[model samples]
Target: MRETSQLPAPGSGAFVFTAQEIRELDADLARRDLLELTMEHAGARVAEVIHARFPTGPVLALAGGGANGGDTFVAARHLHALGREVYVLAQGTRHELAGRMRRRLEGLCPIELLTEERLCAGLSKTRVVLDGLLGTGFVPPLREELTQWIRRINEAGKTVVSLDLPTGLPSDTAGDGSDAERVRADLTLALVGFKPGLLFSEVGEVQVLDLGVPPALLERHAHASCITPEEVRALLPRRVRGAHKGTAGRVYVLGGRPGYTGAPSLTAYGALRAGSGLVALYSRAELPRHPVESMAHRIEDWNALTALPRPDAVALGMGLGEDSVPVARRVLSWKVPVVLDADALQSELRGAGHDAVVWTPHPGEAARLLGIGTGDITRDPFAAARALQLAYGGTVVLKGGPSVIATPGALRVCLAGNPGMATGGSGDVLSGVIAALLGAGLSAPEAAIAGVYLHAAAGDRAYARLGYGLIASDIAHEVAPAWHVLHQASSEIL
Candidate 1:
């Protein structure tokens, strides 16, 4: 879409469209005689990905009787030409295929009619499975027959590569049904652009493949955007020559109780690592130990915040415990940008209408704020993030395996980080990272996007060295290197 020769990276910051929107775009392309060209591109890309990612083994293409089937037929032809063993199992008779699809099917030597025995036997022999059975047009409550085929595919233990999206996954809403209902893909080649349904965990590793669609056509239908490394790199603040601590921006972290001193300490270190000029931790009790570089202040009441040096941005509620509601209310009233996390999210700050505020909440906290079940939040994180942004009137970071960042007008999904980052104090570190970026002069959305990426990248770095044992402090420790790596890459690109 951007007129680049390279394939769209997984997190290319591309616009995400719904299934209906994709169909509309397809119609538009058809009107201009570009529909067939896109199909060819899609088929070629699928074959290429299968060839590159998988070893030299038989590939079974599970094709339906529609446009998706047509694509599969095209891919089968390409794979056959590439000298790879290919098998086709069509959902229906040859008569069901449309004209274009029929021509593509004719190019293949032998096509087997799909059946229970054929599907199971083909899966057992094949090293890879290409799921072109259903694309963006799939609806919920899969037919019993197709469901069984999907079950066999999942159980076959073959590397499943899906075209567009995994079969049976609704292209619009994140299906809240059981995992067995849909085809579980090991890799999904998202054609044209990402669909909202691809945000789920089941989609696996997604790589967007452009069908040479015009950017304007896609932008017209897209409702959300993916957060990319290039965008985060550009958004990161650059330090100038001879800059001092006062000029670098100050950040104040407010949280921590008797047992939860480590939470605020992590936040303070996170801020410092993220390039905060100076960081101060204000808690109810003076901690005996904290980050040596940060100042620790004991505040008896909300009024004490007035006596200290004003911060450019404030991080609230890492471990504020019971005082979160009152502290959040008081700090939110100030004009400075604030990042709300942990206990602060329990506050009744709905509709505060402060655009500078950033709310970072996990599923449980989001459920509390929205008065819904935690399952509901996890079921549709995109909707939950949007709801939180609408209710709190700021950027909302819905933290999960893959976090979603929502603003008043935009939605961004960050596909970084690992399962190792799921350890304790991770969100607190994120809160401080975002707070530091806000203080360093990025807009609320910019800071949230860049900060989220940086935090995830740091977690990945830590995970690489420490494996699953990496803690939140390890993430904070890697922030400097992560920032340096991003900065270096940004400089090279510029």
Candidate 2:
């Protein structure tokens, strides 16, 4: 086990573990007689959560004959011991529960064995259905009976509380295009550490209960942050009294071809709004004739990049089209950090300064960079991201829901943001946000993670103002408000 003292603070993707990996860790725990102790601890923690949330029930636990089921049995015993009328709906049979679990249940309760018929029959009025039928164990496409059962429960709108992860959904993609058939729970009590599926997938609003996995044991394999408010606060530039605009950071936004100019202009504005000291735009066209001219204070020809004042960081390819590729090569041989988005990433991982580049790609752009199909990258993004990060020799922001920020050994998921962020031009704003934070003295990964979280949070705030009608500019507009809320609170709290 890696030392707990050495673990990165939670939000930096430093705690979530895979089911198989955790099972091995638990085996190591059991060889030392710690599995029962761990399960007991887990059950009690779950019980505490149920108590706090419920006022009354006909609580039905859908127990499979597995560790997750065992946890459900343990929870039932504790609740029944406290005089709560709780029942176990064994999805499997008594014969299936014949090992240690049968012995454990011997003195506990009259475990009413469950069937597909029983589950559907009773779930209509049950106060809560504890989804213990599957943990992070099953990947996708439940047995036909289970799929139909989920559809019925969803129709009835019954309250569901899943253990570990919802049943039926692949915790890591081994499904046949049916990701939607998984259990949809209202409350998921994630044990040990958070699993990637819970955050990256739309399971539900999640609550992580500490189950006494020794702090030392967890640091060994898991490296996912269940991002907290405090960690979100530490991302920024420290302002010195004598600091000038250039000294704080000079951010230059480039890349807007004949057909595409709004993208780079938006990128430049996003940098200024994120608090970069000075923002300059070097464009190929003159003001007014170019759509983004109002935002591009400075313009330069394609060959003028060499003579332009040195910028602390550069953002390239928001609007840099395929035709501009030749010009891009001639110009953007960057000395400082650069953000490579859109067309820039489609080129080889390294052209002039790949080591200093930050590649922000939607799955499509990412596929081009990896020389693989988008489906392959989408099915297993974790592996794809690690591959790309090593190939590019820089931080990789695999942007999407629960945006993945990975750099070699590290992989962090940003839990901030909302559904209102699916508008066009969102990526354009994101490229700029990352550049500004990078210029403002954040390391590439820090800037990427913080920039994604803040950008999403700003999108959410923008939605509050204008709902789904939100454009990219509205999100950029809310960046300051969101930053001030977190920054001032950060200055106050941490």
Query: Highest TM-score: which candidate?
Result: 1
**lDDT values of the candidates?**
0.83, 0.70
Backbone clashes under 3 angstroms, per model? 0, 8
Can you write out model 1's per-residue Cα lDDT over 141-219, one digit (the tens) per residue? 7789998888889888889998988898888666665678788888888888778777654566778887778888887
lDDT (C-alpha) at residue 261 in model 2: 67
Which TM-score value belongs to model 2? 0.87
What TM-score does each of the candidates earn?
A: 0.91, 0.87
The residue-by-residue lDDT of candidate 2 on 1-494, one tens digit each, is 11112222333333677777677787788788888877777777777678668747767777776778877877776666666667677755343322355457656665766766777777865788788777766744467877876776566577888888777766664233443587777878888777766655556557777777777788765755545546667766667899888777788777776667678777776777788887777666443432342246444446566676678888887776663455445445555778888877765435454455678988888898888998877766676777788777678988776567777558777666666677777888888888888888787877887788889778778877887788988887788787888888734353
Worst 10 residues of 2 by lDDT: 1-10
